[model samples]
Target chain A: MSETTEKTYKRSHEPVFWGLFGAGGMLTAFLTPVMILITGILIPLGIINSQNFSYEKIHGFATTWYGAVIVLVLVALPLWHTLHRIFHALHDIGINRGRDWQQVICYGFAFAASIFVFTLLLQMF
Target chain B: MTKRKPYKRELPTDWWLKHAFYTKYMIREGSSVLITLYSLILAWGVLRLSQGEAAFNGWLEALQSPFSIFIHLLALALALYHTITWFSLAPKAVDLWLKGKRLEDKVIVAGHYGAFAVVTVFCLLIITL
Candidate 1:
C-alpha cells in the first residue's frame, strides 16, 4: 500500500463522556430518589431525626477517604448524565444556534462542577 | 472546494409539544434540568461542610425551608421518573444472554428495580442507623 493510501482516523471523545453519562445515569436511577427523600423531605421535615444528619456526623463521614469518594460521586457524577441530556434536549427544543458553544457550556458546566466538588473533598481530607 | 448547500427541513420549536409521546419524551429529557439543580445543591452542601459545623448545619437548615422542600419534592418525582425510564430502556443497552438465549426485557427491568430498592434501603439504613 502506498503511503498516501493510508487512512488516518480521527478519534472521537464521545466514549469518555458517554461512559460518565452511563455511570451517572445508573447512580441517579438507583440512589437519587432516596437521597432527595432523606436530605430533602424526611430529615428536613423531622420525620427522620434531624440529629441523624447532624453536621458533626456528615463532616466526620466526609473526612474519611471512602466517604469523600462516595460524596464526590454522589454530588458530581449526576451532573455528567443530566448535563449531557440537557445539551441534547436543547437541540430537541430547536435551539440550533451555536452548537459548538452549546456543547462547550454543557460539558464545561459538568466539568467545572465536578472539579468544584473534588476540590472541596480534597480540602476536607 | 465546491460550494454545497444541503437542504434541511425546519423543525418547529413546539414539535415535541404536539404529541403525547413526544411530550413525555421531552419531560423525560427535562428531568435532567432538575436533577442537575439537585446535584448543585449537594455540591453546595459539601462546600458548606468544608467550612465548619455552623456552615454545614446552616446548609441542612436551609433544606427545611418550604421552598426547598417543594423543589426537592419536584426533583424527587422527576428523578423517579428518570429511573423508570432508565430501567425500561436498560434491556436495549444490556443485551444479556444466558444459556444461548437472550434475557427478557421485563427481567432486566425488574432486576434494576430490585437493585434500586436495595440501594435506597441501604442508604437509608446507613444514614439513620
Candidate 2:
C-alpha cells in the first residue's frame, strides 16, 4: 500500500441542527429527573394522589399538555440530530464514498423512527 | 464528464472531526438526550393524572425528597439552557417564502425570543391567578 492516494469528501452539517440538538439535550437533562420525581414518585406513593387532590383541574391540564408538547420535541428533535451526526461520523470513517443512496437510507431510517415514536406516543396518550 | 466542487479545499480527511475540543462540541451537539428524557417524564405525569390524585400525590412526594429536589434544580438549569439556545437558533431553519426569498436569521431568532417572553409571562400570570 502506497501513501494515501484517494481524497475523501466530507461535508459538515449545518448550524441550525447542532443548535437545536444542543437545546434539546439541555431540556431532557433538566426535565427528566424532575418529571420522574413528580410522576414516578408522587403518584406511586399514594400520598398526594387523591380524589380531592388540590387543583385537580389544573393538575390534569398540566399533565396532558406537558406530555403532548414534549412528546413532539423528544422524538423529532433527537432524530434530526442523530441523522446529521451519523452522516458526519460516516464521512469521518470514509465509508460513504459520496453516494446519495446512503444518505437517503440513513436519513430515511431516522425519519421513520421519529414518526413511529411520535405516532406511538400520540396513540398511547 | 468532469465533476466540480464550487467550493474546494484540501483538508486532511476528517481532520476537523478529530480534535478534543471538537469532540466535546459534538457531545454537546446532540443534547436531545435531555429532551427525550424530559418528554418521558411529562408522559408519566399524564399517566399519573389519569390514574387519579393519589397517584399524582405519590409522585409529588417523591419529587419533594432532598435528592429529587437537587435533581429538579439541575434539570431546570439544563432546560433553561436548551430553551435559550433553541430560541436563539430559531431563525435559520424557518422557511419564509416571500417572493421566493427568506427572512434573515436575526429576525427569526428575535421573533422566537419575543414570543417566548410573551408566553412565559402569560403562564406566570396564570400560575399566580
Candidate 3:
C-alpha cells in the first residue's frame, strides 16, 4: 500500500476546553476524596456523627455565599472534565464520525448542567 | 507484471490492557468517571437542599446506606489515584518564574502537595464546624 499524503491543518479551538479540563482535574485531585471521606466513610461508619450533615445544617450551609461557591465549583468543573475525557475517549475507541455533533453534545451537556446548577444555587439564596 | 499484497495489523480495542503503561494511562483517563459521579452526588444534595429540609434529610438518610458507603470507598480510591497522577503532572502544566529563572520541578511538585494538605485541613475545618 502507498503511504498517505501529509497535510497541514489549522490549530483547534480546544484550548478553552483544555483550560476547563485542567481546572476540573485539579479540583477533583484535591477535593473529591476528602468529600467522600466525610460523606461516605465517616458518616456511614459512625466515625463522625450522622447529624454533622443533617438537613438543617446542610441547608444552612447551602444558603451561605461561600458554601454556594464551593458547591458550584465542586459540581460544575468535574462535569466539564468528565465530559471532555469521554469526548476524547470516543475518538480513541474509533467512533470518529460526526465530530461536530459529538463536540456539541458532550460540551453542551456540561454547559447546560453548569447553568442549571448555578441557577438553582442562586434561587436558594 | 507482478502484484503485491498489503500487510496490515489491526490494533485490538483492548490494547491498553496488554501493557502496564497503557493500562495506567487508561485508568488515569477513566478516573474522570468517579470525579463526575461525586460531582453529581454533590449537585443532587444541593438540589435536595433547595427543595426543603425534608428532602435534604431524605437525601442524607439515603447516603447512610451500606451501598452508598461502598460506592464512596470505591470513589475514594479512584480519587486518590487521580490525585497522585494529577499532582505529579501539575508542574508540567503550571509555570513559576523567579529572578529570571524557572523553578525546579521538585519545588513545584512539593508546593502542590503542601497546598493539598492545607486545602484538606480547611475542608475538614469547614465540615466539622
Candidate 4:
C-alpha cells in the first residue's frame, strides 16, 4: 500500500522520436507541394517534358553524392514522421494495448527502411 | 476521510470526427500516409536506378500510367493540404527574437514561405534546367 502511494515519475523517451518527427514534418511541409507540382501536375499535364525526370537525368542525379544525400533525407524523414503519427493515432483510437510492441514495430520499420535506403544509395556511388 | 470517485470519460473510436478541430488535426496527421507513399515511390526509383538504366526508364514510363497519374493527383492534394497546415503551425513552434523584442507571427510565417520559395526555385533549377 505504501509502495502504491510512493511518488514515481517515469520519463517517456519521446523526445528523440519527436525530434525526427518535427524535422520530417518540416521537410514534408516545405517540399511536398513542390514535389507534387513537378511530378503530378507538370508531368501529367505535359507542362514539363518527361525528359526532365528521364532515366538518364535521374540516374545521373542520384549517382552524385549530393543527390544521394537529398534522396536519403527525403525518403527517410517523412517515414519517421508518418510512423510516429500512426503510432500515436493507434492510441487516439483506443488501441492502448501492446504499446511497447507497437512502438517497436512502428519505429523499427522506419529505422530499417532508412538504413536500407542509405545502403542502396551508397552502392549506386 | 471522504470517499471520492473520479469522473471517467471514455474515448470514442471516432473521436476525431466529433469536432471540427479534431477532424482537421486528424486529417493533417493522416496526410502523412500520402507523404509516405511519395517517399516510397522515390525510394523505389532510387532502387531501380541502382539496378540498371533500362529498369529505371521502365519505371519512369510506368509512372505515366492512368492509375499512377490518379494516385499522384491524390497525393498532390493531400500533400498540398499538409503543407498549408504545417506552414500555418510553423510560427507557433518557432520563437524568434530580434533586439530583445519578439517577432510577429506574420513575420515568422512569411519567412517560412520565403524560404520555401527559394528552395523550390533551387530544386526547379536542378531538375528542369
Candidate 5:
C-alpha cells in the first residue's frame, strides 16, 4: 500500500468536511421550507376542493428569493461532504486497494453531478 | 455493588459537544425524536385535510401559537442537524463505483446536497410565482 494507515487518530479533514457542511446547510436553508409550505397549502386545498388541488394548476406563490439562493448554496456543499466520507470509508473497511484509484472515482462522479446541476439550474433561470 | 469514592475530578468543558464522534452520533440518533414529532404534525395535517376546512384552519392557527412556534423552531434545528450528518455519511454506504473506478465520498455528498438545493429552489420559485 503506497498510503499510510492509521484509523484511530483524527486528521483535520476539514476541507472535505466543511465542504459537505456548507453544501448541506445551504441546501437545507433553501429547500425544506418550501416543501413544508406546500404541504401546508395542500392540506387546505385537498380538504376544500379535492378535484382542483393539482400543483400544476396553482400559481407559484411558493417562489421566493430566499429559497433560490439557499438552494444554490446547498447544491455546492453536500457533494463535497459525500465524497469525503466515502474516501475514509474505503480506507477503513479495506474495500478499494489504492488511494489513486479512489481519487479517480470520487472526482469523476463529482464532475458528472456538477455538470448535471449546472445544466438544470440554467434551465430554471 | 462497589464503594463510591469522591475525588474532585474536573471534567472537560467541551465534553460531548467538542468531540466529532459524539457530535456525529448526536446528530444521527438524537434526530429521531424530532422526526417523530414532525411526523405527528404532518399526520395531523393529513387527518384535518380529510376532516375538512375548519378543522385544518384550527390546526394551522395552533401552529402559529407562541408555544407551538417555539417547539417548531427547536425541532427544525434538530432535523436540520440530522439531515447534515445523514447526507455526510451517504457516500460511504454506496461503495460507489463508476466504470470500475470508485468515487470519493465528498463528491457524492456534494451531489446529494446539490440535488436537494436545486429542488428546494425550484419549488420555492414555483410557490412565490
Candidate 6:
C-alpha cells in the first residue's frame, strides 16, 4: 500500500463507559423502585419493623462476601448510569462550554463514589 | 490555524419544554438526577455502616425525618419512570430471532415487566421474610 493510502484509526474510550452505563441502567430500571420502597418508605414509616433494618442485621449482611458485593452494586452502579445521562443532559440543556471538563466531572464523580463504597465495604470485610 | 469558521446553529435551552414528546424525553433523562441522589444516600449509609453500629443507626434514624421521606418518595417516582422508559426501549436492544422470525416488541417489553415484577417481589421477600 502506498503511504498516501495508509490510514490510522484512533480508538474511542466510549465503549467502556457505555458498557458500564448499560449494565447500570438495567440494574437501576429493574431494582431501584422496590429498593427505595423497602429501605426508604416501608422501613422508615414503620410499616416494616425497624428491627428488620436494625444495625446488627444490616452490619452482618454487609460483612458477608456476597452481601458486600450486593451492597456495592446496589449503591454504586446506578451512579454510573445516572451520571452518564446527566452528562448528556447537560449538553441537551445547552451548557455547551467545557465539554472535556463536563465529561471528566461526570464520570469522575461516579468513579470516586464507587471507590468510596468499595473501600468502605472492604474495610467492613 | 486555517480560518474555516463553520456556522453553528444555536439550541435554545428550553427546546425540550416546547413539545410534549421532548418534555417526556427530558423527564426520562431527568430521572437520573434523583436516582444519583438516591445512590449517594446509599453510599453514605455504607460509610456510616463502616463507622459502627451506632453511626449506622444514626443514619437510619436521620432517614426517618419528613424531608428524607419526601425525597425518597420523589426518588421512587422517578425510578419507576426510569423503569418504564427503560423497558419500553428494551426491544431495540434485544433483537432476538427465533425460528427465522423476529420477536414482537410487546412480547419483549412484557417479558421485561414480568421479570421486573419477579425481581421486585423477590427483593421485598428477602428483606421482610
Output per-candidate TM-scores for chain A, rounded to 2 decimals: 0.90, 0.49, 0.85, 0.88, 0.48, 0.91
Off by over 4 Å in 2: A1-55, A59-125, B1-24, B27-30, B95-102
lDDT of 6 at B110: 98
Please write out the lDDT profile of model 4 over residues B10-129, one tens digit for every residue: 877998899999999988888877777888887787788889988887777777788888888888888878878888988788877999988888988888888989988987776677
Rank list by DockQ: 6, 1, 3, 4, 2, 5
Report the alpha-carbon TM-score of model 4 versus the true structure. 0.90
TM-scores of the models, in the given order?
A: 0.92, 0.48, 0.88, 0.90, 0.46, 0.92
Candidate 4 residue A98 C-alpha distance from true site, Å: 1.1
lDDT of each: 0.93, 0.53, 0.83, 0.84, 0.52, 0.94
True-structure lDDT of candidate 1: 0.93
lDDT of 3 by residue, B1-129 (tens): 669888899988888888998899888878777767777787787788889988977887888898888888888998899889988988887778999888888898898889889988888777777
Q: Write the per-residue lDDT of candidate 1 for residues B69-125, one digit (tens) a residue.
A: 999999999999999999999999987799999999989999999999899889899
Residue ranges of candidate 4 with Cα displaced over 4 Å:
A1-6, B1-7
Give the per-residue lDDT digits (tens) of candidate 5, residues A9-108: 7776557556654554444444444444444343333432422433222212112345334433334344444454455545544565778788777655
Q: What's the CA error at residue A68 for candidate 6, in Å? A: 0.7
Show the lowest summed lDDT stretch of 10 residues, model 4 chain B: B56-65
Residue A121 of candidate 2: its Cα lDDT? Answer: 48
- Give the lDDT of residue B58 in candidate 5: 66
Q: How would you encode candidate 2's per-residue C-alpha lDDT over A26-87 as one tens digit per residue?
A: 34333333333333344334433433234375354444757556545643555555455555
Per-residue lDDT for B1-129 in model 6, tens only?
999999999777899999999999999999999999999999999999999988989999989999999999999999999999999999999879999999999999999999999999998888887
Clashing pairs in 3: none
Candidate 3 chain A, which ten residues in sequence have the lowest lDDT sum? A53-62
Which candidate, 2 or 3, has the higher TM-score?
Answer: 3
TM-score of 5: 0.46
